[model samples]
Every structure is written in structure tokens, then in C-alpha cells.
Target: RRPRRSAGPVSEAESGGSQGVGAPLGVMSALEKQLHLGRLPPRPPLPGGGGQSGSKMRMGPGRKRDFSPVLWSQYFESMEDVVVENETGKDTFRIYKSGLEGPVLLLLHGGGHSALSWAVFTSAIINRIQCRIVALDLRGHGETKVRNPEDLSAETMAKDVGNVVEALYGDLPPPIMLIGHSMGGAIAVHTAVANLVPSLLGLCMIDVVEGTAMDALNSMQNFLRSRPKTFKSLENAIEWSVKSGQIRNLESARVSMVGQVKQCEGAASPECPKAIVEGIIEEEEEDEEDEEGGGSVNKRKKEDDTETKKEHLYTWRIELAKTEKYWDGWFRGLSNLFLSCPTPKLLLLAGVDRLDKDLTIGQMQGKFQMQVLPQCGHAVHEDAPDKVAEAVATFLIRHRFTEPIGGFQCVFPAC
Candidate 1:
């Protein structure tokens, strides 16, 4: 099915109401004004990484560790940091890789999200199944700062995935399995069709359908547009996300925010003296720097100096407006195109109503293997992680992508 093109553009209300039933009236008036008018109010200056800074300071470890209570406690211990460069642009993006080795599972997150979106289930899958899991921060999102807005297109994103594949798995890599969520799913389809990953053995789409309704697209855009561009604290961001239905739970919301929000070096949350403490600690560390002499320590000192020079703000990591440009075109005729891909495909539908109404077995028959995860939402893995992992492990085993691990234990103790 192909998306129906609109002859004329629609207004904000027509696009979809920005205020949810629970949202206060006029809550988005300021954002709407900014949207219609020119440039948004100048965001406070923050330290600029510009994809070049690889300092551990670029991602505040103490700040990230602070959120462990609400999020996964052992997250930092599980994944290894990775950076991949697009051969064409030579642009490098950050990714977190689960070290388990077998076939490679490359993950692409939805628009406005980064590799951290997969955090909830990444380790679970790795522990349950024998395969390496690589999740990347897409262009214009997270640590990836894109030079060209044009590169955000589906076609370009597909090429970026290709570049990552080449960088991670050489000219002729091992069998590759792609699992993408929402916008990532669209990119995965395009990448598969583009023949970017010759070793691509399978594809999985999470919560996306070809010819996705325009209303759905509009609703998503409206929600993103209406959101406050900055939050005073990560907790504030988490509250907003939970209220807005972007995520269903506070724990997932906090972990997901690690990727979605960036703390400008100067902007400190009013609730805590955490930033003040960090500043004091940095000053003390600088005084003690001579004790540890090495090229690495010298490099760290340079990075610290760079970090100290710029003011930082708390703002979104994603370039929201630029990423929105591809929404309408992304879904058009994608379902059929991906269904026809030579590699086997799996469709994981999350919303119960959608599974009941749109994903009848007869319709799906011979098209691709489809599975429904009960109580899941658009953020399928976060909402129902254990279920998603179980389903994925089964799919991989069925495809012979990996061998079955007997007496598979649940990653989450509650599960």
C-alpha cells in the first residue's frame, strides 16, 4: 500500500491536536507560537561536541550513574561503547554494543530517539541468545551531529546503515540481522532494498506498518512539535514524557531520556547541587593532573579544558524539526517493498487493537512471519521487554540465525 499524498497542507489542529485530554489547555501556546514564528528563542549556549569530542566528559558519567535508581541499575556494566564512521561523509556516530558473539544484530531506533532506546532489552536478548547486539545513535540524534540536513532522508539513512555495516563487519561480514523500531524500521526496509548489507539474513519491524495512516504521522509530529525543547531537570523530562504517552513507565522513560536529552555543561538543575559538585570536582582534578602523566591523561586534560570553556544547557539531543521532514515520505509503499525483500522478514505488532484489526493471519499469510506482543505499545521493547526478547529469540532460532539456549532465564527478575 502506498501513502496517499495530500494536495494541500493542513493546519496544526488538522494535523492533530497538540494537547492531549490530560494536557492543560494553552499548554503548547508558546511552542505553537515559536513553530509558526521564526527561530525559537535562542537556547542557552552549551558545550559543543560537534562529533569530534570523544572525551568521557562529553557524556557525564556521574550524571548518568545518578539515574540508575530509576533506570537499569547495571546498565553501565553491560554495553561497550563503539563509534562508527560513514565512509561517504566520514561522519562518526556513537553506538553501544553487547559483546556476545554470533550473528550481528544491528539496531536502528525511531526518530527523536537514540541507541539507548534499546537499553531495556538489549542485555536481555544478549544474555538469552548468543549474538552480538549493536545499537546506534542515528544522524542528528544523540552523539551524532549531522553536517547536512539532507542526509536525514530515508535513502541517506539507509546508506549510513550500510556504512556502519561495512565499518563494523568488513567487506564481506558475517550474517547480519536488522531489528528496527518505528522510523528505524522504515530505514531498515530501505537499507535492505538498497542491497547495502549483502550478508543481511533477516529483518524485523517493530510497531510500523507500510502505508501507515497519515493521521498517525500527523499525531506524532504534533506531539513532538508541542514538547518543550528543554527541561530544567531529567526528572522534569521524565514526568513530561510519561504524561505525554511517549513512554508508558517512569523507569523506561528515565533510561530513554539518557539518549534523548543532553545536559549543556553550564545548565544545572534547580533541584540538586550536582552540577556545582561536578564543577568543584573538575577543578580539584585539574590541580592533581600532574600525578598521572601519560599521553592519555594529557589528552584528557585537553578535553577537560575544552569542556570548561563552553557553557552547557539541558536540551534535546535530536534535531526534531529536521527529522520530521521524512515522516510523510517514509511510509509510502514501504510495506510491499519490504515484504518483497529476498531476505526473510518478521513483523512485530505491539498495539493490541492494531493486531486484532489489521494483522489477521490470512492477510499476513505468505507475506512474512508476524507476531503480536500483548500489552505492548509503540515503544515495544520498553513496554514489554521480556515478551519482545522471547519473541526475538524464538524468531532467530527459527531462522537458524542462532542456536537455542535451553532453560532460557528471564532477564528481569519480575518476569
Candidate 2:
């Protein structure tokens, strides 16, 4: 069904929240049937080399598709290294910023994804409305360096969000909207609950509903295992990410893939970016975090991933499998937290079925705006950035969070 268009909250019928709750397929519920958790990417074709034994990966658009990684500067105005001092120590968190004025859209990417993941969404949103973007590479993911990267507990990350905001603006900050996707969405809710961002005017969560997320957790490991372990080159990673449906948008994948992988130790290709290829030691030490979480240490797998990494030119920046222990924590009580947020709210999902009981009830009572964008994957912002941007821009404009830039208009009714 097409996404419902309105100036108000989504109706129950349109939300599809009335679907049967039981598992028609024994263990898989009707809701989980639509969930695409960690999509297992097929092995990418290595130039003349084959991908898998039965290679069927489709080629990208154009006669000659370029899979090269794009620089962050192509999308963001500037990148900052905010040094946040706390009881633990001084931690440097990397943030990418854009736009000159108006309210700030503080973006938090999902677990295992980087701030760069928001590159496409940032451009689309800015064009539709007057706003700024501050996309942070969370503690464990991307370029954010923290003393304790393994502490993905809700409390720690919520505190990190507060610390970064405080570090950026001492006491008074601009009117800010906490917009997050997947794990980031949960963090945004927790941040709101903690009253971390005093200037927070709105909250938007993309494609992360507690009910579906919890059910999908049981199959997360299978999804992780099915992914391609390594790429022969940087371009290989981007191509695989797109063709494998990991990220549907090509332009988004080009810029975002670089943040998800790093040059493989002892196997750096000539095409590997200089910055990534040179930080072998720092990255390796970062890997030590897996042990602390007990997710890859005495309590977790002992597989020889080191051998496999050596066989490739590039490998995943974070082995998400090790961080499995924190999965429940990321989403537990997320619904209540999101609903409890007093700020104006928006929930953007890839499918109407994603709406859980709590959120559906809240929407009926007009607690927040819910937009269902079907046909896209879980990475809703990346898959359909224009639609996501339009939905968000309209929500902001309706509430007068910020004035529209030239050539933009608000047609949707105010909530």
C-alpha cells in the first residue's frame, strides 16, 4: 500500500497495526516476515574474479559504474573533533556538520553504521527546509574515539549524547531536533528521556519499532553470518553493499560504505584511502573492545577471523556479531521512552506493519506523526531520502521549527 498522506497522525487501518500477532510460520510472526535486520550481502564480484560459486549479483547502473568511495567533504560542510571531558577522561567524538543557521538536526546513525550514513539524507533535508545537521559517529562506530567503546549500554550512550551536546554548546544550544535511525533512534528516545538536549524541539525515529526489533533479534546472528566477510578492494565493498540490497541507493552507498570498512591489515590495496591504510595500530587497539564486552572474549566466539581478514584488502570496521550482547539494551523499553518524550515527535518507518501496539495507540491519540514509506528497506533514510526529507521538512515547517529556504513550501496540515 502507498504511504498515507495527511496533515495528522496515521490511522490504525493505514498503519496495519491490526495484523495478527501470532506466528503463522511457527516462530516467525507476520510482522517479522517483513523485517530485514542485518541483510546478508552476497560475495561481491572481484573484477575478473567471481563473487560466489554461483554469481548472480547485478551490475550497477551505467555502462561503466564507478564504485569508488566518496569523501565526506562532498556532502558535509565541515567535520569536527569535539573533545568531551568527563569523569572517565577526555574523549574525542567525531561529528560532521552542515548548513549555516536555523535549528540543528542532530543525527545519530544505527549501530555499526557511521555518521556518513546520513550523508544523502542530510543533503535532501537541507534542500527542503532551513536547518543544520550534526551527524555524530557514535562511540563504537565510525571515527568516534572513546575510552570505552564497548559500553553501549543505554545509560552510557545517552550520557555520550548529552556530553557531545554540552561540549558543542556550553549552556544554551539552538533549537535542535534529535533524529535517529535504528539503534540511533533508540538512543534519541533515551536522550530525550534523560533531558540531555535542553533545546530539543522534536524527535524523529526511522524504521525501528520495539516489537519488530525484539522479534528479529533471534535471527540477527544468521543475518550477520551470511554477510560477505571481506572485500578485495574499497570499491568492492560499495558495490556489494548496493547490489546485495544492504543499501539500495547507489549514491548513498558510495559515501557511506567507506565509513563501514577499513583497509585490511597486511592486505592494503593501492586504491585504499591513505587515512584508513595508515591507522592500523589505532584500529587494532579499538578491536580490543570486543573483549571488554565479553561478546568476543571468554564469553563469545573464538573463530580465527584474523586469518580471513588477512586474505582480503578490506574488512568490516566493526564485527557487529561481537556487539550482540547490547542488542536488547539498545531497544528495551524504547517504545515507552519514545512516547514519554514531551517534544513533538515523528516516527518514519519503511512499512506500516512496523508500528507496535504502544506506538499505534500513541499515534491514534496524536502523540506523534507516523509516516509509512513502503518499498524501501530498513535503512529508510538512505533508501528513500527524498521522501524521508519531505516528511521531516513538512513536520518541522508545520511546527515552525525553522523557516523554509527559498523555493520551499509547506502544504501539509499542521499537527
Candidate 3:
């Protein structure tokens, strides 16, 4: 039987405390500090120039420039890398497209994550399957640029997704497979319900419950209200990651990823001007200050900023605390929204973890089918990449879409 649903809303602090139980926050904080500091690699001198003395030297046209395709080969294989400028002019997206012969698959990443999250899986799937794949970094994340926080709303986000889709296919095919994780999943649902993308093939949501964003925002606001202090240095942030075991066995990857997102040179120095990271931290600080007795207008603006920032942290520990409660309303809304779509859908649930089963089952009723992946957790792709690929392959094949060369065999044997 499913556990009884809590009668009232749970504060983000309480939720975080529940998850952080037996976990040492102090040690983790220290480790995170170190990870943050370790991001910078040894810098190489620029070609045709010496250090400092040749800092102003510029290479003339027709000179052979460094085009190290190796660095981006993984993400561009079997796909065309293109940039689409949105009508708003302030926003643009780096998109990767694969396949021309088969149906289209719109791949979306979770919040705070970029399109790179789908690199490993998409590469494998594209090789075997004959379907087109369009992976996009949602606005305010990865390569996509957003000028205003108001653009982070569900409607706006869905429009961004729609814009990317329209740019690529141009109304060529109906029933496009829409797959998203975390915040991306919410945006996918919103787009499908809004009829932004027509002839939806199927929807696959990874580890995100419906309406999880608002709950997460409220929780984060409360959590920040409890404590608001900047880290002394980047090393402190790395140390926090280490002690928290957020990266676990993949310390280097974790370090690299965090470095990609948040890092600035020299200890105790000013933070860098990366818009997304700055926006997130600034919003959090504003929320903290507002809760300490700001005026109504200031509080409302801070609240709006908090919601925008929450979307960027959707896939990480910063947002997980609120997902547990947020999913209830989220899934309920999705249950109603998805009913309008004619395509058969699939819900990949992590079987091993203790999730809200009633919520899961309730949301899938009539509108979609569910598949419980045993021994998997929230990051289903990372935990069981092969199984996820196989499930996706099979779903496409069953729907009369082109199947990959090897058929729908389980790639991850353990899964």
C-alpha cells in the first residue's frame, strides 16, 4: 500500500533535513569548497603568442586556427550542431539534431543541466536507431540564453521548446516523441498540454513529478531564509561536495561539472559574471534578505526571482528536497493535462527507491503506461543508461516507428 499523503505542506528545511539525516553538512561543505577550487586546469599559452609579452598579439585571417574537434566530437556525432536565435533577440539556443529518415525525438534536459547531459545516451541511441533526435539546452541553462527571469515561466519555457522544435522540423511530422527529465519534463508536459507541439508521439518523463517546480521554489526560499552566507572560497564548495557524497565515486567528473557551472579565479575573490550562476545566487540572497522584512513589492520581485532560480537547480541536491512534496500537485495536474493527447505514453519509474506509488499510479491512469525500473534511482539515465536506451528503442518500435539495428535488447544487463 502507498504511504498516506501528508495533510499539510512540508517546509523545504524540514525536507532537506529529512534527506540530510546522518549526513554531515559541515564536512560536506568543506569538501564542496575544495571541489570548487580544483576546477582550473593548467593554462596553455596561446598560439602565435608568448605569455604576458604577447598578450596583445592577434592571429591574422587565413591563419590555421585551433579546431580541436575532439573536445566536441562526442556531442556532434550523427548530429548537426546549430544555433537558433529566438524572436526575443535576447535568447538563443545551441541545438543538436540527429537522423533524417525516421521520426523525431525531442530530448530535453533537467534543470541546471545542459544538453550535454544527453550526450552519452544520445550518441549510443542514434547509432542503432533510425530516428531523428533534437537535444536542446533549456533557456537559462547550458548554451541557451535568457534575458529576463520572467522568461523562465512554464509558458515561456514551453515556447522556447516549441521554438526549437519548429526551427528544426517545420511541421514535417506528427507524433514527435517528447522526453524530458526534471524541469525539462515539466516543460515537455506544459508544451504538450498547450498544443505547442502537434501530433505528439509519446511522452517519457524521467524522475520528475508534475508541478515539482513551485514546491521546489517555496522550499528553497524557506531553506535560504534559515541560513544565508557566502562560502569563503571555492575550495570550500568542493569540500562540501566531497563530504556530502553527492558525486560519490566520480569525484573528478563532479569536480569538472561543478567547475563548468560555478568557478572564479583566486581565493576570496568576487564571483564570475556567468549569468545563470549569478542569477541563481543573487535570487537566493534576495530571498533571504526579503524574508528578513522587505517591503511587499520587493518581496514579490524576490519571490519571482526565486522561482526563476529554482528551475536552474532542478536536477541537483539544491532542489531535490522539495520534489517529494511538489510532485503531488505536479502529477495531479499532469494527469489532467496528458489526457488530451492522443498518443500512447510511457512513464519510467525507479523501482528500487521508495517513491509515492499512489501518485505514480494515479498519474498514469488511462493516459499512459508505466514501467518500473528495478534498482534504479532518480538519475535513471546515469544509473541504467543501457536499459533506458532499450526501453526507448522498444517504445519506438512498438509504436511503428523505426527500430535500431539490434532491436530492443537490454543494454544494461544489471538493469
Best by TM-score: 2
Clashing pairs in 2: none
Better of 1 and 2 by lDDT: 2
- lDDT, model 3, position 265: 43
RMSD of 1: 19.9
Q: Can you rank all candidates by lDDT, best first?
A: 2, 1, 3
lDDT of 2 at 375: 88
For candidate 1, write residues 1-415 as lDDT tens digits. Answer: 2233333544566546554432222343555444533433543444544322222233543333122225433442344334454444557667777745688888999888878888777767777788877888888777765566446788888988897778776787888899999889989999999899999999988988864544477677676667775555566566566555677655667788777877755535442223321111232344356555544555774465456422443567765666566777677777766767888887788753453223344244666777777665588877777688888887788777886555674332121
Q: What TM value does model 3 have?
A: 0.57
lDDT for each residue of candidate 3 in 1-415, tens digit (9 for 90 to 100): 2232333555656446542323223323456535633554555676545653223233553342221112334444443434456565645676666666677778887655556556556656776778777777776665555575324566777877787777666876545889987667777888888878885778887776544434445465565333212222333333333333322222232322332243234333333222232111222344456677656645564565455432222122232333344334334565456555566666676652433544445544544655677665455654556667777877777667776674545342222
- Note the Cα lDDT for every prediction shown: 0.67, 0.80, 0.54
After the best TM-score superposition of candidate 3, give how far the Cα of residue 58 lies from its true spot, in angstroms.
48
Better of 1 and 2 by TM-score: 2
User: What is every candidate's alpha-carbon RMSD to the true fold?
Assistant: 19.9, 17.0, 20.0
